[model samples]
Structures are given as C-alpha cells and as structure tokens.
Target: MSAGEELRARLAVALTRARDRSAALTECVDETELVAQHSPLMSPLVWDLAHIGNQEELWLVRDVGGREPVRRDIDELYDAFRHPRAARPALPLLDPDEARGYVAQVRDKVWEVLDRAPLRGRRLERDGFAFAMIAQHEQQHDETMLATHQLRSGPAVLTAPPPPSPSWPPAVGAEVVVPAGEFTMGTSTDPWALDNERPAHRVALPAFAIDAAPVTNGQFLEFLDDGGYRRPELWSARGWEHRQSATLAAPQFWERDGAGNWWRRVFGVLAPLPPASPVVHVSYFEAQAYARWAGRRLPTEAEWEKAARWDPRTGESRRFPWGEGEPDSGHANLGQRHLEPAAVGAYPAGRSPLGVGQLIGDVWEWTSSDFQPYPGFSAFPYREYSEVFFGGDYKVLRGGSFGTDPVACRGTFRNWDLPIRRQIFAGFRCARDVVGA
Candidate 1:
C-alpha cells in the first residue's frame, strides 16, 4: 500500500478499536451506572464518554479540520486539569444519550478531515501524528473507564476469554543477568512517540539482574505471610506511613476466607487467587516493599528498558521486547483479551532477546525511577499529556497492562501514578545490582 493509504488504514483501525472499546464499556452498564462516580479517583463513566468526544473535536475537528467548534462552550466541562475527577459529576455534563450523539457527530467530522487533510504539511498533521494522538487519547480513557468498572461494586458486566494457558513451565531461573553496557534508552524516530519518549539517548549502566517474569501471586503471598506489611523496616518512611494510614494488608480486592485461603474480587466475582498470574492492583509502595523483602530492589527505568528493549548482539533497541512487529495475540496478553493477567511465562514468543517475558503487557511494571523527561524533551500539542507529570512524586511504570490497548502502548511508552495508588492495574518485577560484575 502507498504511504498515505497505510496511514489511513492504521488510523481507521485504531479509531474503530477505541470507539468500540468505549462503547462496550459504557453499554455494559445502565445509565445510572454510567453517571455514578464509582470511585473518587475516577470521573463518571459518562464524563469520560463525553470527554473523549470533546478531545477529538478539539484536536481533529477544530485543530486539523479548521472547522468552527461544534460545542465550544463545553470545553471547560471536560478540561481535566480545570476540574478534578471527584468534582466532575456535579458539572453540567452530557448524559449518556447526549454523549453518544456528541461523540458520533465529532467522529463523523474527524473522518472527513482525515480523508482530505494533507498528512505531511504541518507539525501536528505531519506523519498523521494528530490522528494517532487522538486515537491514543481515546484508548487511554477506555482503559480509565475499565478501571472504573473494576472499582464499581456490582455484578460483572464485562467478559472475555481467559488468556492462553501457559505453554512453558514457570521460569526456573528467578533472574536474568544484563551485562554492563551503554544502551539507547528512548525513541528518536517513532512517528507517534509521545514527547517524553523523544530524543533517544545513550544510557550507560552497571551489570544487573532482573526477574525473568513478574512476581506472582503465590510468591507475594509469602511476603504477606512473613509480615511484609506489619514490618515497617521493609518500607520507605513515606510508604510505611501510607500503608499504615490505609491499613493495607494485601493487594487491593484481596480477602481471606474463613478457612484463611486467599481470594480476590475480579470484575465483581470472588475467586481463588490465581497463584501463577502476576500480582496486580498493588501500589508502588507495595512493590518496593516486596522487592526489599525479597532482598532486591526495583529496577531503575533505564535498567528495565535495557532488559526489555536492548539487543546485546545488535547493540540496538528493538521497538518491543519480541521485535519491531505490532503486538498480536501471540506477542502479549493485551487489549482486554483477558479480564485479568495471564499466568507468568505464558507468552514465550513475546520474550526479549535476553529472555524477559511479558515485558509489553500483563501488568504495568513499576520501575524505581521517577517520571522525568529525556535530555532534549519538548512538549508538543500540549504540556498536560506528560510534561506536567514530570517529577519525583509519580513513579514510572513500564510495559502495558491487559487493560492497555496496543495502539496506546509501546516499549518506550511511559505510565506514571502516585506511589499510593492501588486501583491501577499495576505490578512489579524485582531487580538487583550484580555485585562485582
């Protein structure tokens, strides 16, 4: 296919996927459920629905199409920075029916703009970046809406086939050694890469060992059994305070039966904890404490990147752990293919060159590094997408979770959350410096 044809095809697929996922999530619940704020941490599902439409109108219809705003007055209603999520329900926001119609109208105009716009003329339009950005934005909200579903207390309204059963036994070696070297740490040429992932730079690091797979539920149970939560020394001062304040005893949604066996609430269904799946819904503090309890440390962002993307033989970075190919069912457990994480070591085909498994999906793996910019970072389109979040307060998360759409995820893609957030689909793999390597 011609370049424009290829871009249009990809854009069409991404847009369709984003819309479908959003619809599926919203349609599963009644209007009351859509309007209810499931958690203070999240906007009402209906708000996300309308907000997705507003953003598309802003970026694609107005910015790219040069059209007059359809509902310019409503922009502030959806301005995420202008209104916190908790207060969004009180705003005069579009209801479910109105949101669907509004988004449909905006999407119709966006399609017309996409068909005729010179895809190479302007910075935002160049290489179809604006279209990609909107697609990514909508997919991100879909993930957020999914999180709201997880937090909502109701019967399950979502369903998906379970991830493939493991094809290989659990990894025997707990950790893989990454030799000391300089590795390229970000992307310089990826057309749709966000600003933070720009200006790929060389990062030199000492030899280290990282877990072959994420720490599993059974393993984390051992930490809990050993008083990992009660022992304050295992946590950072801030982490300990947060833990004590929240009275966190285990990962979110976990409960013990009268028999003392562990069960977890998954999409409103209480089931025995899948011992082999990577532990999810844990905060950064919990991950750090677990690393300490295991006599290891969380990998720095650089170390985690090297393990997942760097190819020692080529001395170059691969777009993904497995290769430059787009993610598919064979590559990773992503795109809500499974409502929960697959068992660790299930995706051997997705392993990195150095043998790291499930680096692209399953759960967003917490890294030790703070979320910061690259050497020559410059915000594009807007600063809020990433630039504003650059600081020590937000811990960096690499890899995507099952809730993450493939169009919105990449090896260099960065996700960040506060250390105390436990509602996100996050987990961690431990790393330790190789002494005297």
Candidate 2:
C-alpha cells in the first residue's frame, strides 16, 4: 500500500482508539456531576473534555498548519492552555455532544488532509505531532481522573479483583547482583522528554544490595504498625508537614473498617489488601516516609539505571530485567485486561537482573532525587515542558503505572509532580546506599 493509504489506516486506528477511550471513560467522568475534591488536579470535566476537543481540533488541524480552523466560533472555546483556567470561564464552551462534534470534525479533517499529503511539510508533522502529544495528554488526565473519582467520591464499580494474574515471568526468583558502577542518570536526550527527566549527568556510586522486588503492602504494613507515620524522625520536614496536613492514616486508597480489616481500592473495586501486591497510590511524601521508617530510602535514579544497564556482548547481566522488549501480560500490569492491579511478583520475567518484584509497570516507584535538569541541558521545542521547573521543587518518580503507555515508560522518560499528591496511580519501592553487612 502507498504511504498515503498507510497514513489513513494508522490515523483511522488512532482515532478509533481515542474514541474508545472516551467511551471507556464515560462511567468514570460524568459532566453533570460536581467535580470531586481530591481532583484539584483538574479544572472540570467540561473543561478537560473541551480542552481535548480544542487541542485535537484547532491546535493540530488548523493553527499549527497555518490554516483557519473549521469552527471559527469554537477557536477559543476550550483553549485552556493558552487561555488559563482563570480565563476559561470567559470563553464560550461546548457541552458533551458539541465537544464530541468538535473532536470528530478535527479528527476527520486531520485524517483527510494527511491521507495523501506530503509528510515533508513542517506544517503537517508539526500539527500532527501536536495531536500525538494531545492524545498522550488525554491519557495522562484519564488515569488521574479515574483515581480522583474513586478517592474523592466513591468507588466506580464494586467488585472482587479478577484474581491473581495468570501470567508470570519464567524466572520466578532470579537475582541480578548488579555491580557498583558509575553511569549517567536522568534522561540524557536532545529529544523531547519531560523537564523532570532532563539534564542527565554522570554520578559515581559504590556497591549496594538492591531489592529485586517492589515493597509489597504486607511489608509496608509492618512499617506502619511499627509507627511509620507517627515517628517524626522517619520523615523529611516536608514529608511530615504533608502527613500532618492530610492526617493521613494509611496509603491513599487503604481504609480501616470498623472491624479493623484493611481494604484497598483496586481499579474502582474495593477488596481486602492483597498480601503479595505492591503497595500503590502512595505519594512521593509517603514513599519517603515509609523508606525512612524502614531504615531505607528511595533509589537514586542513577542506581536504578546502572543496575538495569545491559551489555549484550557479555550476556553477563540483563539490562532490562525482563529482557530487551516491551512489557506484556507476562512482564507487567501495563496495557492488558485494564481491570485491576496485579499481585506483586506476578511478572517474574520482567524482573530486573537483580530480583525485583514488579519493577516495570505495576506502579510508579518514587525516587529520592529532586526533579532537576541535567548539566548543559537545553529546552525542547516546547519550552514549558522542562524549563519552567528547573528550580527544583518536583521529585523524580520511576517505574510506570499499570495503565501507563508502554512507549511512554522508556528508562529516560522522567515523571515529576508535587510530593503530596497520592491520588494518582503512583507508588514507590525502597532503596538505600549499601550498608555494612
């Protein structure tokens, strides 16, 4: 088939996927309902949905291409990025049906124009890339919205977890004794990575004993029982402040019932906390606190990458704990059933050379390092992604969440956010500088 036909086919599939996502999210986001409190992260369903429409339609189809938008009237309707949240109300907006129509119109136009069009035009790729980016943006918001709906409101659907994941890595209990080595950390890329992952650098390190598995809820519960939260000495000042302010009694989704039984929200369903499951939805603050409480700390980004580094010639150690490939059901709780968080240790094949449980995708492990750009780092085409936050407030987060796009989980892909945010699908695994045996 010609490149043009291929583009259409690809575009068709992509649009269909986005549309499917909208349908899947229908149960999660109800425009008529009041926005939940835990979701201070977003403006409103209308705002977000409309923003998607505007971004997909106007930003990609017309503006970036130097063409006029199809709907002149809707140009500023939901342009929340350019028109900030404070200014969002001033612009006329669309209801769900209208928003969908706007999205469809843009999607149709994008497909039509690109079908037989030149890929060489700066206008097309520039605009097309925007849509690609917009799609990613939507996905990020989608997971957060789901998390907020459950945390701030109530569980979307109450059901038992589907059951332990049927798939498991072949080497159930393998060990990757990663040698102590110095390596560059953070995303060392000239290409576009989020600001948090930029300014990669070389760091020296000594040997350390690294865990092959993520710290499970069962393990973390022990720390909690041992006064993980109450002990001020175990927390950073910032972390303590967050704990006291939120009055956090446990991990974000965990609840202690009248009977004192522990339950956790797993993909809109509440069930008894799985003993072997990796504790998820814990924020950076909480992760830090837990690490200190356990006499450990979050791994440095350097330590993480060095251990996972692969030397193909040596075959000595696996660079990717699960081998050089994308994650599947056998590797991590990433793109698959979409029903629930799998049990920790469910993906043995995906384990790093060192024995780590659920390192790749079950949850986003919080790292101790502050989110900062690497030395000699420069901004990407979009300046806002990395340059704005170089002052060092954000914290580095690692691994990938269950629903994170596999392509987005590259080792260099840096994720950062406020420490107190526990409503997202982030979780942490503990690390420490090597101590005397």
Candidate 3:
C-alpha cells in the first residue's frame, strides 16, 4: 500500500473500533439509563455520545474539511471542563435519540472529509494525527461510559464473552530485579502519543525489585484479613484519614456474604471473588497501603516503565512488554473483549523480556510518581489534554485496563487520577530497593 493509503487504513480501523465500542455502550442501555447520572463522577451517557460527535465535527469536519460548524450553538454545552459531570443532566442536553442522530450526521461528514482530504500538508492532517486523536478520544469516553455502567444500579445492560482461559502457569509471587541504569522513558516518534508522553528522555534509576505480576485479589485479601486497614502505621497519614472517613473495608463493590464468603458486584451481577485475578477499582491510597503492608512500595513511574519496556539484552526500550508488535488476543486482555481482568500471569506471551507479566493490560497499574511533564514537553492541539493535569495532586498509572481500547494504550501511555478516587479500574504491583545490589 502507498503511504497515504496505509495511513488511511490505520485511521479507518481506529475510527471503526471507536464507533463500534461507543455504539455498544449506548445501545445496550435504554434511553432512561443514558440520561441518568449514575454517579457524580461521570457525565450522562447521552452527553458523552453527543460530545464525541461534536469533537469529531470540530476537528475532522470544520478544521480538516474546512466546512462550517453544523451546530455551533451547542459547542459550549459539550465543553467538558466548563461544567462538571453532576450538572450535565440539568442542562438542556440532547436526548438519546437526538444525540445518536447528531453523531451519525457528524460521522457522515467526517467520512466525506476522510475520503478527499490530503493526509499530508497541515500538522493535524499530516500522517493522520487528528483522525487518530479523535478515535482515541471517542474510545476514552467509551471507557468512561463503561465506568458509568459499573457505577449504575440495576440489571446488567451489557455482556461480552470472557477472555481465553489462562494457559500459562500462575505467577509465584516472585520479584524481578532490575539493575541500576538509565533507560529511555516516554515516546518521541509515536505519532498518536499524547503531549504527556512526548519528548522521550533518559531516566537514571537505582537497582530495584518489582513484583512479577500485579497484586491479586487473594493477596490483597490476606492484607485485609491481617487487619491491614485497621493499622495506622501501614498507611500514610492522608491515606489513614481517608480510609477512616470513607470507612473502606475492602475494594469497592466487594462485600462479605451472610456465609462470610467474599463477593463483588460486576456490572450488576454479584459473583464470587476470583482469587487469581488482579484486583481492580483500587485507588492510589489503597495501593500504597497494600505495598506498605507487604513491606514494599509502589514503583516509581521510571521504575515501572523500565521493568515493563526496557530490554536488558539490547539495552533499548521497547514499545510494549512483548516487544514492538501490536497487541493481539494472545498478548493482552484489552478492548473490552472481557468485562473483567484475566487471571494474573495468563499472558506469558505479553511478558516483558525480564519476565514481568501482564504489564500492559488486565488493570491499570498505579505508580509512585506524580503526574508531571517531561523535560521538553509542549502541548499539541490543545492545553487541556495534558497541561491542566500536570501537578502533584494526581498520581500516575501505567498500563491499561480491560475497558481500554488498543488505540488508546501503549507502554508509554500515561493515566492519572486523584489519589482518593476508586471508581477507576486501577491496581498496583509492589517494588523495593535491592539490598546490596
């Protein structure tokens, strides 16, 4: 295929996957569910649907196609930062049917733009960056909507076949040692990488030992059984206070049945806790507390990246744990193929060269580092994407979750959230300094 044809093909695949995922999220629910604010933490599903279309129209149709705005009046209504999610349902927002029709119209225009536009010339059009950005953006909202589905109380509205059963031996709680050295962090050449992952730079690190896989539910349960939450010394002052205020006994959605067996609610269905599966819906404070209870610490962003992407044999950084290849079903559990995380250590083929497993999917792994910019960071397209969130307030998360789409995930992909937030699909692996290394 020619250069432009190849770019077009990639963009087409990304956009198709994004649109399909978004449709799946909305189509499964009734109109009432779409408009209902499941939680104050998320926008109404209808709002997300329309906002996706609006963004595509603004970027692909108006900017790329050089066409007039289709609905200029509602632009501010969809501006995510302008209004909090709790207030979204109060606005004169488009209903489900109207939102779907609006998106369909915008998509038709976008396809027209894609057909005739030169995929080369302007910065946004060159190499199809803008198209990829929009696809990623839509998929991100799909993830957010999935979170809403999890938060909403009612019957199950979505269903998907489970991921392939584990074929590899379970991780035996072994820790892999990474020697002290400098490895490249972030991405410089990845065209679709956001501004936060830009300007790849070298980072020096001390020798450390990291868990081979994410901490599992069984492991975390042991902590809880041992009064990990009750001990003030095991938690930071802020974490202890937050735990006390929230009265958090276990991970969100988890409860002990009348028989004293652990169960968790999954998309409105209550099921027994899978002992081998990696724990999800954990906040940074919970992760930190678990690490402390285990006499380890959460890996620094540099440490986690090095363990996942640094190849010791070549002394080079890879795009993913399994190397430069695109992820497949054999590699990792992503793209909502499974609503829940696969059993830990199931994806041996996706393991890093150093034998670390499940570094890219199953759940987003929390890191010790704060969300900050690279040394030579520069915002592209807009500042709201990354600049506004660059601070110590938000903790960094690496890897992606089962709800995440492949187009939006990479080894260098950065995710951040408030330390106290537990609604996200987040987990962590413990790390510690190597003694006498």
Residue-pair clashes per candidate, as listed?
0, 16, 0
TM-score of 1: 0.99
Better of 1 and 2 by lDDT: 1
Arranged by TM-score with the best first, the candidates are 1, 3, 2
lDDT by residue for model 2 (155-234), tens: 46422335355355323223344555556565443232444556666666776655566777787888888888898888
lDDT of 1 at 223: 96
Cα lDDT tens digits for candidate 3, 39-120: 9999999999999999999999999999989899999999989999889999999999999999999998898899888988
Query: Cα lDDT of model 3 overall?
Result: 0.92
Q: Name the candidate that leads on lDDT.
A: 1
Q: How do the predictions measure up, each by TM-score?
A: 0.99, 0.82, 0.98
Span of 10 residues, lowest total lDDT, candidate 2: 166-175
Off by over 4 Å in 2: 1-15, 27-31, 34-38, 71-92, 120-131, 152-177, 184-204, 266-268, 309-324, 435-437
